[model samples]
Target: MPSKSSSHSWHVFTATQDPHHHHHHHDQLSYELPYTMEICMTELDPVLAGKFFRRSGDEKSGHSAGKEMTELTGINEINKEAFICDFAFDPCGYSMNGMDGELYSTIHVTPEDGYSYASFECAGLVNNDDDDDIVHVLRKVVQIFRPGTMSVSITTCSEYNNEVWRKVAGAVEPLGMKCRSCAVDQFPAIGSVVFQTFTPLRWKNASK
Candidate 1:
């Protein structure tokens, strides 16, 4: 993103015109309070990343592979109580969605050699617990991927905005990940949007 751009950047995330927001499921989320999470991870552990690749060439369908991966990756351990549906792509890749009542959590992985990436997100995950719940969920994801670098973005409705946005660093730093950058912005009905980037302590001095 450039410091000075044409009118393109602002239009990029505007919900009203965003094609994703126009999608059926997203379009239906008219919750009075909605908290959305986005996490991008890169440089995953080779040993763990390799597990996402298919074992038997064409022996299994996508759903079968995904089910194996869900247990293989301990994704089921993330939330023992929730029922999960997972699918693995033919050659390599995995995705799953877990639903708990009306709320949901999802994970996607592209566990390739040089460009491994994974993400986890939950929708309006916690109606309460403010930052505590956010910390718990994200930390679990960090343990799974153990990415060398990661960035997180959180969007929440006005009600929990104040309590949630400030906790990103506190949730991740104890695990040896250091918050490298933080930026914030407000959206029309989305309330607060906070973005933060992190690197492990081995990468740099976490202290200011």
Candidate 2:
């Protein structure tokens, strides 16, 4: 039986630090201005997981398989400048990393029956004026796994905008998952964190 613990989750965080601070004069100056988003999915649909398998005689290389999935999922089009490095595992699994200048995106999958799981993560500038980009990306990620349950966490500086989560919820709920809980907290000087949980309508009905 598939574990009920299986679920998907997302986390996004943004922060800025002074590169020239005297306290860290010896440290290299590195800063990530873009927000980060992580989405995890578990208890994957067997039919969908089958798509990640590599056939015989095919190049037995992870990079090749990763590249194939990247192209198949249209991830390459997400950022024109993004350079991808991917891998495929024996039996069934895939992983990829996308680099676009300073920003990065990564994906990993485990299609096994007992512990099926997948994750998609990316870093990019936040556009408060429009969230369509994120919504589109997330929609695609969810489509890939069609998970039964999911959770999302967003972290950003104290001044971080709250509208992003609303948009995230909006993007996910339409796919049959409904938000069940939302929690907010602070991380001292780091930023604020918001964690939300969701479950598919069918799952909720089953539990009831």
Candidate 3:
């Protein structure tokens, strides 16, 4: 993460509409606290840069191959997990085993509440379907971390094409959060998309 001081030209736009309209069109738009994160160009590893597009067994490197879905969505007492070692990679060069094969990133979810955290990991496997699991897990964290705040930011500085960033935007933006990019210089060949969001002040009534 780049220091907040390292100034770089940032392009701000809404993934949906400008200043999300509240219900009744009368509810005042909440003030969004300012926060920024820097995504370094080096942060994107080769495995995540689309290297494991659609290869069968995890041949790229000796590690885990295929997708696994763990039930982190605490609700009904049900545990479900699946792997796609037999399936071939999809046309997009990712796992064809639904969204599980498409996700290529990881996020550590430590909810504000006492919930055993979980890690979502994928080596080079890139696809669109992976968003739900990622977002679902992150959303839960956001609720636990800053319940009053309705926004969150996913920061990365990995070397990736615009398509990867757009996919990230598509996954995160809908969850009522703003997406931001860092390390613009890294993706000179391809434009970088950065987003901004606010973290609610937990001590709104307390003195500074």
Candidate 4:
């Protein structure tokens, strides 16, 4: 049985008030530029998740093995424009950071038994409903590591009240997921955060 919400067990990543914001007059810093902070944490499918596992006799260094995984798993394709720096843990795990111009994205993987977990973060803006950067990247990340249960959150320093927040669920649901819970919170300083949890539709139905 599976189900989903703000059940944020782990903070994949978060925003911080820049120390350089020496304006003590204000409690929080303002987003001078409009961009979305998109993050996703997923329990990877057990069988497919084994890709991050180390082979029994393979003597490849963690760095070497991780490099292989990055290439083998199609991570390089996620952002052709970004330069990627990736690494693999001693036994089993993967991490990557990509930079494209001023924007950046990161991915971390933890192969915990059948509960292989992966999280991703990207900085981009949802320009229009037609085609945008963040959504496209999110979709590619999802395809790379299909999750049995997934939770996603998006925050923007722009007018995303009815815009980017809704787009989070809309973009992922078509991928065989059912939104279990959604929570909205006003950013302490400015902007808004939309958090949603999900489980595979198949699992949702099974639970019922």
Candidate 5:
């Protein structure tokens, strides 16, 4: 079962140290600035999934305050969902909301099959001048994915430069992981990197 606190949660994408220090508390501008992604995944918990799908497709959900929230779509139907992208171009800032800490637009994906992945452009914060901070963020992501699994792969770096990625892979190779691999592309100007994974479904036997 999904924990009570983890379900139907809210997040604030702030560029300021104090997110609550609103530019205008009573106006729509308060929410317009923050890039928000409402997370709706099917298998965060099966019990929740059953309850959610039980209602009529047009029925209002308690979590939505009478607004109808529909069924999952595309990759969202899987047990794991896609990483939410944040394209805000700004410096990092401290966050004080739920699971609060220093937050970044960077998104990391972790599958229950013991594999973790990270995808960011070389021009992003992951490859910024601060090497220590970059490693620390990656470590935090690893902890989120598999608490004890040290092996990870840098699956996507949008700045299609192998030499730069090689340097990054080498830097984190010693971080208590069995292996560190780089998944890259050759001519990114004409092509992009795409990653895919599968989810397993189980069935029971029937007797005649």
Candidate 6:
């Protein structure tokens, strides 16, 4: 078992509207970006996972629990303009959805023995300068779950390039994880996809 590990995957797809349709009505302006990220993790620390559990006898709704977790996890701090909707599962789990202007982000946690898992996903418009934002978000997520292993998938139009994966690797490696492998491929007309895997340094040493 790797002490810390991660992977990233990317995809690209066509846009339904003209690329120059930014002048459309605000409501018609979907926040859908040219890319998407699906990051997954496992082997979460029990102490950190426990934070997802609702207090005993507390009958708050899932939305309420989500709000509390979001605040506690500093998800609210990521983008103050984003409207958040969240839910808390019984015993130990949490999920949240956030929309900031046109961007969307979501998080889910399943902290159970034998099947511990968590995921973070988001979509937004990005320019060359947005790499720092990815780093910040990725780091915050790792802090939340402290997973021993993780995988990240990024889907984006071919025109967008693949620099984001390097930033992703930079964000998590300092936390004691190391990148083990990276694979890239094109999805026909969809675009390009990149998959990167990471493992904890401790695990690497043990395997040797």
Clashes of each: 1, 4, 15, 0, 0, 22
- TM-scores of all models? 0.77, 0.77, 0.29, 0.78, 0.28, 0.79
What is the per-residue lDDT of model 4 for residues 1-208, given as tens digits with 9 covering 90 to 100? 1124434532434456752332223234442334655555567866656777778888887778877888888888878888888888767789988898888888888978655778888776444444356667767777778787777776655345566656666777788877787766554444666667777789867878
Model 3, residue 136: what's the lDDT?
Answer: 48
Candidate 2, residue 94: how far the Cα is off, in Å: 0.9
Q: Pick by TM-score: which candidate is best?
A: 6
The runs of at least 3 residues in candidate 5 whose Cα sits more than 4 Å from the true structure, single-residue gaps closed, are: 1-123, 126-129, 147-160, 167-171, 187-208
Q: lDDT for every model? A: 0.74, 0.68, 0.31, 0.69, 0.26, 0.72
lDDT of 1 by residue, 1-208 (tens): 2112122121116455443332112333333445778788889989988889998656988888898888988888777777899999878999999987877889999999898999888875554534556787788888888888887888875555566545778887888898766666666645667767778988775355
Local distance difference test, candidate 4: 0.69
Name every residue pair that clashes in candidate 2.
Answer: 8-151, 10-153, 62-87, 62-88
Which residue pairs collide in model 5, if any? Answer: none
Model 2 stretches with alpha carbons more than 4 Å out: 1-33, 77-80
lDDT ranking from best candidate downward: 1, 6, 4, 2, 3, 5
Scanning candidate 1 in windows of ten residues, the lowest lDDT window is 2-11
The Cα error of candidate 1 at residue 159, in Å, is 5.1
TM-score of 5: 0.28
Residue 203, candidate 2: alpha-carbon lDDT: 69
lDDT of 3 at 118: 23
For candidate 3, write residues 101-185 as lDDT tens digits. Answer: 4333333322222222222333232233343443344444333222222222333323223344454445445544444332232
How far does residue 164 in candidate 2 sit from its true spot (Å)? 3.0
